[model samples]
Target: MPTLVLDTLVNAPIAIVFDLARSIDLHMYSTKKTNERAIAGITSGLIELGQTVRWRAKHLGVYQTLTVRITKMEKPYFFEDKMIQGVFQSMDHQHLFEEQEDGAILMRDVFHFRAPLGPLGRFAEWSFLTVYMKRFLEERNRIIKAVAESGDYVCYC
Candidate 1:
């Protein structure tokens, strides 16, 4: 398994940042390059605990469908989503939010995932999947930060 962690700072309210992080619309917009879309379940709006979402997207030149369920949520502070069905053997992503003294919010993402195919998967992770996933998360966080700081997050949330 590989773990990827990232922290993004946003000059916005924690609640707004958290909401945007779980917004289906915002996620779809952020991943437009991959043509990612919510194909079933909670297809739009904010995803809550126990809600599952099925996403269809093009990655690595192939189209894949992934289903994830929000396993835990604590309002504007924390949330956890785990993969129910996807290409990976297992995937868990934790979103944590902390408010700064300056009113900014620090959004941290802790992602853990394992690839299939045993040794071949290990090689993929060591070679490019890790980097690809990191870049993917970074791009998503970048969009979330931009939307949160722009005061236009209300539309997505």
Candidate 2:
């Protein structure tokens, strides 16, 4: 398994940042380059606990569908989503939010995933999947930060 952790600072409230992070609309906007979209289950608004979302997207020149369920949520502080069905053997993403003294939010993402095909999968992770996934998460966080800081979260939240 490979784990990727990222911390993004946003000059916004924790609640707003949390909502935008779980917003389907905001996700679509952030991943437009990959043509990612919520095709089923909580497809439009904020995803809640136990809710499953099926996403269809193009990655690495291939189209793939992945289903994830929000397994845990604690309002504006923390949330966890896990893959129910996807190309990966297993995937877990934890989103954590902390409020700063100045009213800003420190959003953290911890992603852990294992690829299939045993040794071949290990090679993939060591070669490019890790970098690709890191870039993907970074881009998503970038958009979330931009939207939260700009007060544009009203549209999605």
Candidate 3:
């Protein structure tokens, strides 16, 4: 398994950042490069605990679909989503939000994933998947931070 952690500071309220992170529309917008979409489950609006979303996207020149469920949530503080079915052997992503002393929102993302194929998979993870996924998450967070700070997140709701 490969684990990735990312932190971003947004000059916005924690609630706005949290809601933007879970907004299906915002996710789609953030991943426009991958042409991602929520095709099933909660296709739009904020995703709540116990809810699931099926995402269809083009990654690494291949089209794929992955289903994930919100396994845990704590309002504007934290939320976790785990993969129910995907190309990966397993995947879990946690989103956390904290209000800083400066009143800005600090957003953190922890992502863990394992690919298939045993040793080959481990090699892939260490070699390329890890870096690739890190960039993917960074790009997504950049969009979230921008949207939240600019108050454009409301347009996605």
Candidate 4:
């Protein structure tokens, strides 16, 4: 399993960050390159546990549809989504938000992924996906932090 953990401080309230993060449609705005569109399921409001969302997007020139559902939810604190069916063999992402001093928020992401080909998959991750994917998420975190700090509604379209 390849795991990535990233943490950042956003100049926003924990509730605001949590609310924005729990909305499935806001993901597209947060991501930098994964230009996704929510096709089905909850498009607005906080995504509750067991709620699933489908998205269609072109990743690396290949069109794909990913369906993910909330596996865990803890108010303005933590939420985890599991990939029920998607491009990867397995994917689980946990999003966390915490109140910090001076009224800022600490946001973090933890994701685990497993590929199908075993050793070949490890090799592929070492060759490409490892840093590539990590940087992708980091960039998205930056976008999310920017938007949340600005306290504006972003168009994920």
The lDDT per prediction is 0.97, 0.96, 0.94, 0.80
lDDT of 2 by residue, 1-91 (tens): 8999999999988889999999999999999999999999999999999999999999999999999999999999999999999999999
lDDT of 1 by residue, 1-157 (tens): 8999999999998889999999999999999999999999999999999999999999999999999999999999999999999999999999999998888899999999999999999999999999999999999999999999989898998
Best candidate according to lDDT: 1
How displaced is residue 14 in candidate 1, in Å? 0.5
Identify the runs in model 1 with alpha carbons over 4 angstroms from their true place: none
Kindly give the stretch of ten consecutive residues in candidate 1 with the minimal lDDT sum. Answer: 146-155
Better of 2 and 4 by TM-score: 2
Q: Candidate 2: where are CA atoms >4 Å away?
A: none
Please give, for residues 114-145, the per-residue lDDT of candidate 4 as tens digits: 76688988887788877877987888778778
Candidate 4 segments whose C-alpha is farther than 4 A from its true place: 154-157
Model 2 pairs whose backbones collide: none
Which has the better TM-score: candidate 1, or candidate 4?
1
Compared to the true structure, candidate 1 yields what TM-score?
Answer: 0.99
Which pairs of residues clash in candidate 4, taking residues 3 or more apart in a chain or in different chains? none
Residue 97 lDDT (model 2) = 98
CA lDDT, candidate 4, residue 34: 69
* Alpha-carbon runs more than 4 Å astray in model 3: none
How does residue 31 of candidate 1 score in lDDT? Answer: 100
Worst 10 residues of 3 by lDDT: 148-157
Candidate 3 Cα RMSD after full superposition onto the native fold (Å): 0.7
